[model samples]
Target chain A: MNFIELTDQPIDVAKVLQSVSHPDAGGEVLFLGTTRQFTAYPDSKEQDRSGDAGGQHTAFLVYEAYREMALKQMERLAEQACQNWPLKSVALVHRLGKVMPQEASVAVAVSSPHREEAFQAAKWLIDSIKADVTIWKQENSPSEDAQWVHPTNSGAAHE
Target chain B: MIQIRLFAGATQLAGQSTVELSPTDLPTNPTVGDVANCLTARYPQLQSLAAKSRWAIGSEFVELDCPVESEHSLAMIPPVSGG
Candidate 1:
């Protein structure tokens, strides 16, 4: 079964993995994305606007989505992945609402008859979701006001 | 009337989640670009976003010049940040 969901609750990685488990599948790959304390916005001049150009700390991140659109796009991506790979199943879950540091915000699992296909599909699914989904994240920083992160511009920075 | 939904920073800038426009406000058989131009004119704050954002009819993203039906759901999607 193909599974797709957007929820306010924390993502259950194990459940997502189990949902894609199949006897016919020889390989399964899971990817987890967690909220981090440091985030950098390379495309935006927001850092300068906040007067904290050198340092920015994320207290938390609040995720929001155009729900119906996001779900539809996700389902489309899942279908595309399945068509591109010989897969057993696919599961994708993204968390909405406030996600604290170190909390899992998204999870993806893909199972296939071989490791290569599973790995490729898993990577493609996550990358496509990041690039195409209609979800947004607001980074709340202690030193500066909150900013809505632009998809292509922002990335987690190790503190 | 057509309702244009806004999300993320676009919503924050416009100070409203949705913008309503009468068909008379746009050109005949308005394209997505025409709708965007009308919105920017009505809400100058949306100008910058309108320039960069993608347009969506219902759940599908469309080209700026794509024809829009007044009855369809529309949204201005700022750059997505999903994981």
Candidate 2:
């Protein structure tokens, strides 16, 4: 029912999971999201320099969020999940500021009396965080240019 | 008095994180609409965005008529993207 948040550093999924663990909890699920190195359009000018095109595609992403609102929304979502699921604990951590490619962007850890609830709650928290939270990231790449990415059904490039 | 917060592009323009205004005498409480008008008076640049901008009293999104007092932190949140 409690969540801790910090705007700096990469998220430690294990630490978050551990912090929310409970004696009666029988299932734990952890989700970690990392920045992808490539732009939505891989063939664009912002291609990887090392030529390991398949490697992490992003250089750095600047993250901004409505801190207070995000916290409250997260709390509400956790409470809803607890009500709908038999969860003993739910912990979500998001990294703000500039995050490098391959670095963790967000983490959600949930512990419940059953694996089904834990899994479902973890997935729901991540999805809702992405869709509802007022956090934004501008992708920075090797070309010294940055682009703001917005969600699209086609997953098209934002440029 | 009601405190207004600036964020993202709005913060960049305001040059400060927070601004305080006296919407009305204390006790009856000032509504978000009153706060918006006060914001426009203080920052003319915000006049246009005020109509569409989301207002947050503390952490929750509130309507213009929601009663807000001096103690709450009112913030202007522009559109943002995050995952």
Candidate 3:
């Protein structure tokens, strides 16, 4: 069963893993992209704005998407993965809005007849999602300061 | 009028998620670049972000030179930072 979704609900990793399970498949790969804390670097606009700059932990994240477009892009990438590999099923999902640290913000799951293709497709899907998907995230610091992660600017350095 | 959807940093800078601008201010048969130009002219704050943004139509991204109609759904895609 191929399952795809964008939700504000918490991700169930087990459910994602189960979505791709099939009797014919010998391997199933699931990757969860979880949120993690980051330190605010010096001279960042985020730093200057918050005045709580150097080395503060991020408390949470707020994610956004051009919803319809994000879903379309996810579907396109999932279909592309299937075309490039031999897979039985696929599950791609992302969380939107406020997500606490250590939460799974994104999940990619795939099943294939063999181990090799399953691993390959799972990696490709996650990488492509990072590159092409319309999803975006903001870092909410412990001080409640929020800064959008712009891949081209300061956050790009930390990333 | 062409409607533009903005997100993340672009939305933050524009102070709104979406905006509609009359195409009358643009040249005849305006292209994606023209739309972008008109937007930046109206919201100069978007200029910096626009340097790295991508103009998209439907599910596919379009070049700045591509022609667009008022009815088309257009979006400005900023440098994405998703997991």
Model 2 bad stretches (over 4 Å): A1-3, A20-26, A39-58, A66-69, A141-159, B22-30, B37-52, B70-72
DockQ per model, Cα: 0.62, 0.24, 0.61
lDDT of 1 by residue, A1-159 (tens): 799999999898888999999999999999999987866554446545444444458999999999999999889889999999999999999999999999999999999999999999999999888887899999999766888876544322200
Winning model by lDDT? 1
lDDT per residue, candidate 2, A12-57, as tens digits?
7767988888999888898888887775552334553454455325
Taking the tens digit of each residue's C-alpha lDDT, what string does model 3 give over B44-66? 99998887788788857888999
lDDT of 1: 0.87
DockQ measured for candidate 3: 0.61
Write down the lDDT of every candidate, Cα atoms only. Answer: 0.87, 0.73, 0.85
lDDT ranking, best first: 1, 3, 2
Residues B1-83 of candidate 2: C-alpha lDDT, one tens digit per residue: 57787765566567676888875633356688877877877788877656556677767777778888677888876555566
Tens-digit lDDT string for candidate 3 (A9-107): 999888888889999999999899988676455345654645454465789999998888889888888888888998999999999999998899999
Interface RMSD values for the candidates, listed in order?
3.9, 5.0, 3.3
Point to the candidate with the largest TM-score: 1
Model 2 vs. true fold: TM: 0.71
| TM-score of every candidate | 0.91, 0.71, 0.90
lDDT of 2 at B40: 79
Question: For each candidate, C-alpha RMSD in Å?
Answer: 4.8, 6.6, 4.6
- For model 3 the TM-score comes to 0.90
